[model samples]
Each structure stands twice: as structure tokens, then as C-alpha cells.
Target: MKDKIRIGCGAGFSGDRLDPAVVLVKDGKLDYLVLECLAERTIALAQKRKLQNPAWGYDPLLERRIESLLELLLEQKVKLITNMGAANPLSAADKVIEIAKRKNLSVRVAAVVGDDVLAKLDVAALSLETKQPLSSHGKIVSANAYLGADGILEALKTNADIIITGRVADPSLFIAPMLHELGWAENDFDRMGKGTVLGHLLECAGQVTGGYYADPGKKHVPDMVNLGHPFVDVFADGSGLLGKVNGTGGVINLDTAKEQLLYEVVNPHAYYTPDVIADFTSVKLMQQAKDRVRVTGGSGTTKPDTLKVSVGYQAGYLGEGEITYAGGNAVGRAKLAGEIVRERLRHTFNEIKVDLMGLNAVHGNALHSTEPYEVRLRVAAKTPDAALAARVGEEVEALYTNGPGGGGGVRKYVHEMIGIVSCLMDRNLIKPEVIIKSI
Candidate 1:
């Protein structure tokens, strides 16, 4: 075998235009395709969907799309990797298997999981940065760890035509196969670095292809409905080139790629990942014209001493209904009324938290931990669902008191009980015990 590989990234279920993106890669004769669909909100969305109908969510959506792609890949014999499993990669695989059997495609399917750790956070543990115990605000909410490139490697080993995973690092889907086919070890820093950078470049798919680049005006965007998914050509030496599915929406020139690079990376020289800390400072970029950018010249080294953990703590609900101000100092009147409500609640309740939404400069120092502002407020607290929390919310609505300094009936203001859940995680736990089974 020549050991050559090309990778693509994007969701298979966005609009009616999903087929064009995947079929384009099949037509292009690429060796492998990687699709990523898991987002921060995806876990919750999946849970909600499952709640309504236990058999629904990202997995089925992904399975249907993969079936389409698999038929084409089988016709051309190309492998694939994806994280469309969202919160349930296994369920996604099962669905794909069923579809394959029905079609008599016999396309081998592999699933990578243990990445969706939405249920893993321990409130008693402190944050790596703040060193404070996590709040119980969202103690029972969702959390998922970002897996690295190894899962894709495992998929390739199965000789499977398609690999499905949940919440793997967006970049890993592209890099893992290249590392595996080329025989890059767990510690091959240089190659891993190249793969990591390539993954990051194409992870957002069309985003790097001028989706959010600010350069092209909205009216001038290429085929908005058929946005192109990203792809990369990795060489044996760990060097690579990035592009996308043919005839798709958006363009991937140097400017757009550079803009995507700046989207999240703070320091180019020290791009960190769960598997390795890649040195992107040595990287080079060149504008290869309207729809292409040439990325080269980057090196990698062993990973950092600490693994990054993504923690999601309990943050309470936030509700806001607008109230218009027409009178003189209407904002001031609202502020005073809010304060009175907070004071009354505090006086009536013990060990309960309360705040007046209109009177506090929440966006200022009070909420942001910066310098306090003179006016502007949003009430919230950790009090029980019924006590000060709900009471304070109701108080904000009762600001139209008929007493002194109160005349204009306060418009019904939306009251919300807010809890604090920190979604930040930085704990690294590699080398976990994997209990694999033949499905």
C-alpha cells in the first residue's frame, strides 16, 4: 500500500446540502473522511432529544449520512472517521450497523467513546486555575472530555470503512489516521505536531474557508447553503496541505486560514493538545490563491506535564424579560425598586442570597469581578428554588408599588433564578482502562 491519506471534516446533517459535501470527497478519491459534529451545546441537545424520543439524536442523523457516504466509499474503497456520535457514539454505530445490514453494504463500523465525560465532574474537586472547589450549581449537569487522536488510530486498525466517536477533539479526526498509517508512535512529537495543526486548521470545516473571516461581505459569500467541509493531505514526513470538498460553499485561502488560526489559539508557538504540545511558531502560511492556502513548517514536542480537563459545573438558569423606560430617570426608579425588593427578601430570609436586577451594574465589576459600576443591575442567587431566589425574581416584577417614588405600574419583568456552573475543565487523565467488546 502507498500509505497515502487525505482527510475531510464537517457535519453530515446541517442543511439539505450535506450530500454534496460528502459526495464531493467520494468523487475526489480521497482515502479517508473525518466528520465532527459535537459542540458544547450538543450534549444538552442530544439529551433533550433522547428525552422526547429515546431513539433520536445526533447518532441517527450521523448514521444516515454515514450510510450515504459509506456506499460511495465502498464503491471507491475509502475509510472514514467521525465524532457525530455526540453523546452516544455507540448508539450511532449500532444504527449505522443496522442501516448497513439493510443495504447489504457490509461496511465495517468502529466506534470510539469514553470522551463524553459530561457526568464526570466531582463538585468537591477544585479547579486547576482557581483552586476552588467546583460549585454545586450544575452538579448534575453534562460534561465531556475531549479525546485525542488515538481513537481514530484504533478505528483504522479495525480495517473498518467508517469510524464513529463522541466528543473527540475536533482536530484529532484528521490527524489520527495519518499518524496510524504512517506508524507515528504515541511520542512522535514532530509528526503529532503536524497532524495537530492540520486538525485545528480544518476542524471547523468551512469556518476556515471564509465562513467567519470578516473579509468577504455577507452578500458575497460563496454558496451559503452548500458550505465545503475541510480536508487535509498528510505526507509520510508529517507535512500537510489543507483544502476542502470540491465545489462546496466558501473558499480556503491564506487569509481565511489565518483568521481561523486566530479563532482560539492564543500562542502559535505553544499550541497545546491532550496528546502533545505542538510548536506552531515554526509554521509557515502562503496564499495559494482564491480557494487554497499552503500551510507548512511546524514542529512538535512531547505533551505538557498536565492534561487539560473541560469541567462543566452547575450554573443556574438565567431569565430576562425586557422592561422599557419612558419617564425621567426611569432606569433610576427601576434600580431603587429592585433594591427595596432585595432588602425585603434578605430581611425575611436567613442565609439566603438575593439581588435586585435593575439596581446592580452586573456587567460591570459586580458580575465580571472588575471595577463596580454606579448603576445597572441583574438579580440572582443560590437560594432555594422557592425562597429568596424566586421571591427576589418576583420582587423585580413588583416594582410598580403605589407608594412614594412608585407610580407608573412596573411592566411585568421576567425574573430568573441564576446558579453558577463553570464549564471550564483542565484535568488530564490519559491511559484509562478501556473495556472493549466486539459489537
Candidate 2:
């Protein structure tokens, strides 16, 4: 059995930088490169696209990413894995073929499907959060379970060059290759848990490497625009050394590592997953050198009887308008403009959000300030009908000639909103399988 394997994260989310991944492939000495690009609402958004055309539910950036990285990965003899096949892995697999064929390169591609359980979902079942059923939503769009590593492993067994998955657990995508490469038994809980923590750290790609952790001057990071992605030298014992590539512009320290450790961690003791009941409390983090950390010792409880599923629904439509005002009493003028929009759309829309940008949009009037040269009044609303939502922009645009003086740079936009609901279901309800097509 191989004692060690290196896995580097190329794209963290759907819109991550592409150039940094090329650096990783060229210099990281990796066995596998992973791209985790799915978010809770990403699949729902993809489903909306698929409704318009059956062949288009996968990640929108799949083709671009493959074209950029295919030849480099092929040269390095590194395998690739991704959840870029957001809602349609099969279509994504076919798209990869088209990209590869254009470059005159042959590769094995596998699609991991069956996470979409919308057809089998019980609409009447109560939610895991609000105890409300799926019937309460305006309309159902997509429901996908967080699949485990079985399908990914099944694909790797066929010696596929790339594995595309739909709705797999964020960390599981990283864990499968470790388990497969190291010859770790599937039932080994402690090793899986340890490997999972490493995966979690790298899953967000740059987050663990000072991309999101950097605060200019306060928690300063040098050359953050060209932030480096993370890769782990994983050992067979379920431990790994975390570090970024050399000649990159990001810091990797205990602080960055610990921040990512606690991110999105609802319960430190019970970090639930489809594969195992991962316990983060047992994991140890030790900084052995600059931009390097030694990770060891994580254990897991028994696997959960139920799996958490994310259900997406057609929530409503959102319409928004923004107008900027500068010089002398800008905040006051913006506030007045906000009131005008609220009164105009309050009766028609379900919810209206009025905020003054650059002042209180993020904290919500907490740090009220009057000394400001410029302010932007943004009015937005959500409604069942797109027409009503569009009214928010129309009304805000009217402020240019209809009262608030100095209101310039008017912009308006409207888009469909997708909301997510969480639920738990029997593990047997959904089965994930690998479908392979070689070119």
C-alpha cells in the first residue's frame, strides 16, 4: 500500500480563480486534484437551467475549468475529482469529453449520480428544522442528498481519469481518493474521520490558506490577490501535513487553520455526515513550520441511520434598485429615498429590504454614522410574481427626477430566488452509482 498521497484543491467554489489551480498542478506534486464547486443553492440554480434545456444542469464553469487544466493534469498523470456536475453529472461527463477531444487528448470520465431524490421524496414529511413539510413551499425545484464516497471509489476502481459527482459531501470528495490510494478499509472509522478533517480544511480551497482569513493591516496577509490553494500529504494512518505551494502569496498558520476548523461547525462533538459520525474534538492541530501544519488523531462514532438532504424550492423573485448620492447630507437623503421605496412597495411585495450602502447595509444600523460624503440607497423586494418584484427597481429609478436630489448612477436588476430547506431521510432511499464513458 502507498504510504502517502497528495491532494490539492483547485477550485474551492464555482467562481474560484483558475490561474492558481494551474500553479498547483504544475508545482504541488499531487496525486489528485479536487474541485468542489457546489453550494446549497447551486444545484437548484442548475436545475432551473436544466428546465430550460435538459442538457444543462451541471456546473456552468465545467467546460472552462476542464479546458484550462486538462492538459496540465494529463501531463502530471494526476487524477481529477469534482462536484462540478452540480445536478447532472452525466451531462457534465459528456461535456468533459467534448473539451478533451478538442485538444486531441483521450481520458476516462465517470459520473456519480443518484443524489437527486426529488421523485422519491415525501412532500408531506416534516422538515428537520421548522417541522414544516415540503408542500408548504411555493414550488419544488430539486432535492439532493449529500452522497458518500462509495460512488467515487467505484469510479476510481475503473481507473477513470476524472470523477464527476452530483451533490456529494464537500469533504467526502476529498476523502474517497485518500481511502482508495492508501488501501484503507471502508469500515475504518478513525482513519476516515481523520482524513475527513483534512478534506474539510481543503474543501473551501483558499479559506484554509488565508484567502478569507486575511484582514488588511489587522490580520495582514501579503499578496492575497494571488492566494494559494491547499494540498495535503496524506498518510496511510489518516494523518496529513497541510501546506501551500512555494512562491505563493498566502499564509498558513495555526490561526488560519483553527478558523477553518470551526467554520460551519454546528456541533463540534457531533459533526454528522453520510459516511460516518465524524468527531472533530479528537483531532489535533500542530504547527510544525511556517505555512505548514501537522494534522493527526481524529475519531468517529457509528454512522448515522439517517442522511441530511438539502431541498431546493422556487422561493420567489427578487427585484432590486440602487441609486447613489454624494456630498452634503448624503445619508439623510438616502434614508428618505429608502422610506419612499418602502411605502411604494410595502403593500405589493412580501418583504422589502431598505438599506444605505457604505454605512449600515451589513451591520443593520448598528454603527450609525452621519459623517459620510457618499451613500447609496438600495431598495429590494421579494414577491411571488416577477412583475411585483420588478416594481422595486422601477420605483427606485423614479427617484432620479421624482424628489431625492443628486441621486445618480441608477441600476436595476431582477432574478428568480431559490431557497433551501433541510431534511433527514432513511439512508436506503437514495443509492449513488458510477457511470463511466471513455474516450
> Best-fitting candidate, measured by TM-score?
2
lDDT for position 176 in model 1: 75
Residue ranges of candidate 2 with Cα displaced over 4 Å? none
Question: Relative to the unseen true structure, what is the Cα RMSD of model 1?
Answer: 6.6
Q: What digit string (tens of lDDT, one per residue) describes model 2 on residues 23-53?
A: 9999999999999999999998998888899
Task: Say which candidate scores most in lDDT.
Answer: 2
**What is the per-residue lDDT of model 1 for residues 189-238, given as tens digits with 9 covering 90 to 100?**
88888878787887776677666654445425678566666777777777
User: In model 1, which runs have C-alpha deviations exceeding 4 angstroms?
Assistant: 1-3, 12-20, 44-60, 116-123, 135-137, 214-220, 322-439
Quantify all predictions' global Cα lDDT against the true fold: 0.61, 0.89
Q: What are the C-alpha RMSDs, in order, of all predicted structures?
A: 6.6, 1.4
Model 2, 74: alpha-carbon shift in Å? 1.6
Cα deviation of 296, candidate 2, in Å: 2.0
What would the TM-score be for candidate 2 when compared with the true structure? 0.97
